[model samples]
Target: MSNSNLNSSSNHFSCPKGGAGYVCPDEPQFVGCCSQDPCRNVDANSTSPCPGSNLYYASYDPFIHEEIPANACIDGGKWFTCTGANPSFIGCCASDPCKSPDHTGCPDDDLLPAAWSKSRPGQFALFQDEGTADDDELSGGAIAGIVVGAVAALVTIGALVWFFVRRRGNKAAAMSGHRHTSSVIEGEHRRMYPCPASPSFISSWIGAI
Candidate 1:
């Protein structure tokens, strides 16, 4: 029942001999192969036993050999453990939408574990960090989208700033040019008629504009 090798790279197991390898059966007594899973034989409550029961596997056990596809652990989002009515003979789950947490030892993607009843119930179980695994599931597309959005926002902001600055500079340059033109005209008029043009001439030229 030692779950020491649970969820590791290899699925090697160390099953005990005879009646000492089953968990939660009608009795602690179990003999022969580790076929009778304890997840189904656990303490039942209410009218139906396997309708919505959650499956939980022992991280470590002294007398059980946990099977990945066994109906002994509660890890799926929809069904914790398959009832006799909806027994998962072919597969444990169809598709995983409800992602598994970091400590659950599930894949980074939304897929559920291939099997159930992992890690027998006997040895000291090593639980994963209770942190969330959603970050691990971020796809390349999602990350790229975020990066593109950020860059586009920055470029837009820069363009707007440059437009305003260029517009302001143009206005200032125009104003200076107008002032210079006016000064040159006045100076030229004074030099052309040092005695000052006749009131009629002044009125005809400067007053015209």
Candidate 2:
């Protein structure tokens, strides 16, 4: 078959009326809405008829591939023709073979399109791995900080002990010195109380007596 014929299969291949031979680009290839046939001759049907057909066959711009609109295919074999001029339909069909315009009986969101959840299974494990390393680092820092603080406290306690000891020693020395001075003064006063007679006075008194 020619490349055109091969590519044509990508479009609607059969007629909309469930006929085996007739082919139209505007008509859905499948006999019923659920038919697996592709749309044909999208180049000829620039203006789409059959607005109610759920299936659409159109060539995409830039890639030149045929596409089917999502939820655009119907049971009557007529492709739902989009009157809206937006070329989004073209891109949608070109990318996905099983495009459905209507989300009926379909998932609210396409799991294939939202692929970020695939990595979710291991996310908690990854976070824990990183957190474990961080925790080790934090524990080491805390231990070091505690050691330094304890050493500083010990030094402070030692200094305070030395200060108190030195103060007591000085106080004891001062009290001892004061007591010695008071004893010496009291001894001198007792000697001064007994007055001594002169030698001449003693001789004269002896003679007179």
Candidate 3:
């Protein structure tokens, strides 16, 4: 496909660079009009590129795995739609396994489109949200997260309470120190005080004077 030059090899022609305007499929495993990059003429007898989504499989392998069931799911299979049918059971997703289904799962031998229906689609439950709340209305992971958040909140509140209590103690100590520091100056003394000298000592001191 990388080579642009193409020529005839035998009954079939090798078109590495397909014909003009022949756009190759995005995936190398996908089917295209021609095997090469740009799809070229299907037959040497003809002069124009193959049209109508008809792919000449030179390198493309429709089936990648043997485990995949259903022919329609193969790579080269056309873009078909049952339209109100189980495309998955019939090999729709098999063609492009990259695009998985989120619907119910299907048994290997299920009756495909014939048994596919809206009321009872298939069995394959594809890409289901395991995180969704279940019968208990709460997922296990969600419950764990809630518990962790609550614990963190409780720790934060406990720390705040301890900090406020310590701050209040410090403020009370400062207030007590201020109360003890208040003093009476000589001229501003309002509180009266009694002298501690004895009455007999005062009478003897008067005889000495």
Candidate 4:
């Protein structure tokens, strides 16, 4: 069917420049209201900007071969708890496909958009056959980073140890050189001032007698 026919059939309306303020965790394909229940609308006809949380892009789960609930955990489609005045309700993220002007995937077989948990947020789960490729890539990158950091730390420690050892060796060598110079000076003094215990002493004794 044409895009205009889909919009008219669904009774579609535009949300402001950015679209819905809150995401529909149950059916991320549709725009959601800020109330505890995504189905409840504060003012359906109002043209004012949606007053609620920030909008996020839709996260496609290739494993499921479908779009999982917005902001829901990929491991188990677990809904995150919403904070603020409505703490009892769950929060959602990701873009609403139904909000698109082109009426992309928003049209359903009934020619109606998502209405409050129609997508069944609880049903989404990762397929076991393929596993989570994205998560695995992230894990590999994290491991590489840790290894690089460890190597860098070891190199820095080695450099510091070598510097200290070289400085200590030079200091010891200088001290040894000073000691050797003092010893040589003492030996020269002994040679220049010979002891009076030879012919000089004997001549002096004979003269006195």
Superposed model 4: Cα runs more than 4 Å off: 1-141, 198-209
lDDT of 3: 0.33
Instruction: List TM-score per model, in order.
Output: 0.33, 0.30, 0.30, 0.38
Which candidate gets the maximum lDDT versus the true structure? 4
User: Could you tell me the TM-score of candidate 3?
Assistant: 0.30
Off by over 4 Å in 3: 1-134, 179-196
- Worst ten in a row by lDDT for model 1: 82-91
lDDT of 2 by residue, 1-209 (tens): 00122123343222222212212223332121212223342235433212223333332222212122222322222222233323322211222323445422112121111000112232111112222112223434456899999999999999999999999999999999999999999999878786788899999999999
Candidate number achieving the greatest TM-score relative to the actual structure: 4
Lowest-sum lDDT 10-residue window in model 3: 120-129
Superior by TM-score: candidate 1 or candidate 4? 4
Q: Against the correct fold, how does model 1 do in TM-score? A: 0.33
Please say which candidate is ahead in TM-score: 2 or 4: 4
**Model 4: per-residue Cα lDDT at residue 159:** 100
Q: What CA root-mean-square deviation does each model show from the true structure?
A: 16.7, 24.4, 16.2, 14.1
